[model samples]
Target: MPSTPSLNDLRQQQQLAFLAQKTELRIGHAHACPLPPEHLAELDEHASEVTAVLESGLTARVFQLKLAGADYALKKARPNCLVQNLDGQTSFLNELQRRAEIDALRQRHGGFSGIVPTLYGSLAQGIILSPWLSGGTLQDWDERKLIQLFASGAELCRHGLFEWDFCPGNLIDDGRQLWLFDFGYMYRFDPLTQFNSAGQGNDVPEHHLAERIETRAYFAWLLEQEQTRGQDSALAAFRLEKEIAIEAYRKLRLELGADGANGDVLGWLDGLGQQWRQALRGDGEALYWQEGWRSHRLDLDDDIRGQTCTPRTLARCDWMLNALQGNFDALRSSGALAHETIRPERGALLDHYRRLRSQAEDFQIA
Candidate 1:
């Protein structure tokens, strides 16, 4: 009997073939896309149509184009992705795959409200084209934005897709609705049998929709809120987010249960919902501290591992160090360090994180 190939194995095989130019990567929704594959492939030749060039993306460059009086965003994969890891190397291909799945999901389920519509994606051509979103990245988060973001996350979860990266760079708000446009880090899993796409799925229950949102996007923004406004203001914002998350998880629990999801999966959702409910009923200060610690820690680790550390990563490091110095007892009492296999003493933990902070500074991406 043969064993199943690991995700890394599959990714390596795909990357090799893709780099060797042996794989033909072409995908599109005919009803959604106005241009044909041949035209999309030759987009760079029509430089006169380009309105703007955005080179800030790590894995791709985006061109704002005007064709026949209509605007479009054409994303071209960078010859060398800046992320510098296996996942980064194959992200463009992964995105094309997820886009196809998302398009199929939309066809079957009508549409996903918060998700951006994909026009077409071709890995071999190194381009993806979609209608231009006039909206800008989210700067200030409000109840409407929080509700919509979580609702979209829950909807994706119910459909067996787990999006890992919800950073500000990937989110947009047009004053009406939030939109998720990046699928580079999104992965598929069995919602009926797993907690997420990590490990065996249920093994890493801590990494869920809400956790991913908080770790990747919310906490960094919250860190800014804390520094600019104050601790009280940051806490208030976090409370609002939690309130929205509680409702989202509650609905997700009911929906997944109806779909006959695993007992452990449903139980996990119920536990999170109940926990948030209890915290909201009280002051929620302890809950806030615990979750904040977890989110910052996880996000910091992610940035470091990906070698994509930014100034925000350093800010998160400072947050953890401050928490350790001033609120170590609170962290312990809240069970924030319970996830650590070997309990770290205060001094050791501080030194450990300080070294990580140094590494973050060294690896700061341009």
Candidate 2:
């Protein structure tokens, strides 16, 4: 009988598998991209003239390169991922895989209008180049921006690609369009019978497109508004987004149903539509409070675990403490703080948040 592999041996085997798979990715270039052969050959010669270093973390080094009288974004993968985990280690390879699939899909389907155009890439060399996005990250979520985002997400979902991250950094609004340039966290899911790209179709109802944006992006934005504007301003913004989400979901459901969607998927969408419709009629405020708490806490835990804490993390903690102080009973009744072990008194909860905030201050991401 063969001996069982140790944990270290298994890890090594996984690493080898990852490397082999990454090596198999085919290099693809857009026909319209302007870079010539000489520019590709002289990447090293002009390396010192990098216009900007977008990111210098454990995953990859992103540089804004100006060559051939044109600007481009170059991403070079690092040998060791900064994330220090399995997913982190394989993120670059995962991105390459998604890019290849998406690029192919763009050729067959109408096209991914919201995705950044890739120029050239080599998976073996761990490098990808794309046209430089001449836009800034979204500062505020307006109606137009929300529509573009939701439409892009819905389009990807219809094609069986589920994006899991909507963080501020991964998205850019080029005035006329919102562009998604990262695919490290996007995964495949069955559109006909699944709710998202995780587990079974109905296993995780909370992981939908709207929920993802709410949990990962909007809640933090709301926290910031609660300070600069006020609680009423934040709540108003949440309500507006929810209204937009409701319409987006309705359209998605109609399209999926017409496309011979599975009964399970249809039923799931129906349930979501009904819930949002009812919430909009009367229970919207309650829903906002419940989802607001959930989004903040979930996002906070993610940042803390990844050691990428930001000012928003501290702001979220502050919001939590304030909610506990003024509306503890309502929050508790709504199951927002259902998992707490400590007493729900103001002092205890305040201490807890303060400790978390202090720890987060030490781990701010660069």
lDDT tens digits, residues 1-366, model 2?
986554334534665597876555645754543555335434552476478876634467777877678888877777777664566766787787788888889989766899886777766767778888988777788888888888888888888888877888788898999998888777777787788866544576778898888887888888888889998888788878888888888898888888888888888878887877787788466777788888877777777777777787888878887887888777777667665677756688779878888878887866
State which candidate has the highest TM-score.
Answer: 1
TM-score of each: 0.93, 0.85
Report, for every candidate in turn, its global Cα lDDT versus the true structure: 0.86, 0.76
Q: Could you report the Cα RMSD, in angstroms, for every candidate shown?
A: 2.5, 4.5
Instruction: Predict model 1's lDDT versus the native.
Output: 0.86
